[model samples]
Target: MDFNGKCFWITGAASGMGKSLSLLLASFNTQLILSDRDVKGLSQVADKAIALGARVLTLPLDMSDSGSIRKAVSGVLTNVKRIDGLYQFAGISQRSLIIDTPLENDRKIMEVNFFGVIELAKALLPHMIDQGGGQMAVTSSLVGKFGFPYRSAYSASKHALHGYFESLRTENSLNNIRVSILIPGRIQTNISLFALDKDGKEHGKMDPGQANGITAEKAARQILKGLRKEKKEIHVGGKELLMLYIRRFFPALFYYISSRIKPV
Candidate 1:
């Protein structure tokens, strides 16, 4: 669908693919509601969107906090007539083995990555239905479809997204509410640097695979294309895209290969 004159809300708008998407959508003449816990970063992105001649709203949102999400959703409902699109991109990653990872870290990852997206979507579903239809895009990972090393909780959270949104899609088809799960491989972003460790501390270093991955801008463009096509699931990346098929057609081989590959 045409994005011109439409209103889209994006979480994790402070940096990475979300910021890139905001700028790209600005060029398409869309109204953008950008939210993130980083107020200063969000403002910087808003200013850039404003400079690009897009109507922009910046709101503070902490995905781990239900109160913060409720307040942000309230603000959106108060100001915007309808949400044309929702992009759930606020998430943290993990770089530690599940055996060593703390229970709190798993909960934190699930809170931000899975529950946060669900809460916001549930809150907005009624409005979307009232408006006749809307699209929701979620940023999942390659691991969401197939497990990999050092990403047990992260993978589990993303896997939950696939199941939840797929069910939502089936149930909401009559309402015209569409769900698109964007599964990205390794995109060159700072997600790795801020990834949680075994103790919940930051990883503080970028993964080699991520550093060698595609740029966030390219990923955003691909995502937009998939959304426009109304695809149910879109996979974007380099060689990692092959993994999806391998896991599907050759599960035993994929398991052998994946076991040998070091994620970090």
Candidate 2:
């Protein structure tokens, strides 16, 4: 896909898929607006993107904070004229069962993973429409496609994204705004390590399944390839992608596998 002279905003740019995508886009002669609560890490990514010949603006803001998002959006509008693409890769995951997980934890995850995402998208929609149109991509999980064990709240948040963005896609079909939902099964990332537990504390462990998954660079390449064709839904993963199809066509087998599969 050609990103030449296009301005793209990436969240969670400090690490994982977001950072990998940022570095890759830098080589594409693109303008970037990178944001993350990790100020130090964000600076590092920005420096590397700059070195790679990308014009980048780093906005250090928390995804869970509305005030911060507002400030960041205003900051973007002030400096940049138009955003060609806005990729939302920032979100918190959960690793607790429903009975053990309280509403507080559920709300917290929803606040960051769902509300924050939609709020930021809503903030940019008007501007994007007024300036013609643009693409918005959201990073959702395989669990987002089907309800998985140990991710009730997390799954709910992603499911909500599908509903919301799918509607946005059709509603704005005439408006020229493209909404792409990125469903990734497992990529080498720190999401599991930082996932919230029953007590709302970090899981603090690198899941073996996640570590064995594709690299963030590979995931980014696949996602970008789908976005290049303006695909509304992009699923990136190995065999894990089969779950989506099985669940769709063979419900009984899918449930059997889901019930026995380890929550890795």
Candidate 3:
């Protein structure tokens, strides 16, 4: 689990939690493949990693497009001997009532958040397996564990990641492949502003709960610790941590209360 000298391929490395993780991993002296659709932002990440004495590669990527993913992965493989770990953090969030949510927007969320992660993992997993071991970490959400109003599509996509990655872990345990699903309740990130609405426009608004959540740096550190321990599931944020326990022991009551909790 030591990152020193290992190659890491991380999506969404431009900012927020992804950027925090990139910085932390660099401090471990890992070779980094930083990817995102923003070339400028990715360049910034690469520069910082280089300054931290880590080998760095910058890749412009569009997670929703499989063709782009294939090309990016191929490019990374050509530049590096192997990927010791892959963190699937590139995703979009949605915040429209299900009945009013545009079907196209919902599909786009699923494409980027679920299918994109799955396809990329499928492509990279063989290399990890061939090496006889590796790690794949996915970012899910608190909504993935339980549905929330105005985020129906997002909830579904994140829930799907949990099921898929958990199964992959079961199937690949003998190969020493570790899968960690991180459920972050509400981190202070651009997620809310970038969340899509029915018209495919940014929500441009904050949910109070999320706005007051943990900082991305703290969340990333906890995530790295969990991945090092090879935990199957990790929930960050105090509110989400409490909810995790409630969901486990009081499913019906939790569902009833959670369903009634409205967005601020």
By TM-score rank, best first, the candidates go: 1, 2, 3
lDDT of 2 at 161: 95
lDDT of 2 at 141: 84
Please give the clash total of every predicted structure, in order.
0, 0, 0
* Each prediction's TM-score versus the true structure: 0.98, 0.98, 0.96
Find the number of clashing residue pairs for candidate 2.
0
Model 1 poorest 10 in a row by lDDT:
255-264
Over the stretch 1-264, how does candidate 1's per-residue lDDT look in tens digits?
A: 688889999999999999988888988778999999889999999999989989999989999999999999999999999999998888999999988988999999999999999999999999999999999999899999877789999999999999999999999999999999999999998999999999789999988888999999998899889888999998877887998999999999998998799756
In order, candidate lDDTs are 0.92, 0.92, 0.88
Evaluation by lDDT, superior candidate among 2 and 3: 2
Candidate 3 TM-score, C-alpha based: 0.96
What does candidate 2's lDDT look like per residue over 149-253, in tens digits? 899999999999999999998989898999999999989999999999999999999988789899999998998898889898999978878888999999999
Positional deviation of residue 25's Cα in model 3 after best superposition, in angstroms: 0.4
lDDT value, residue 129 of candidate 1: 96
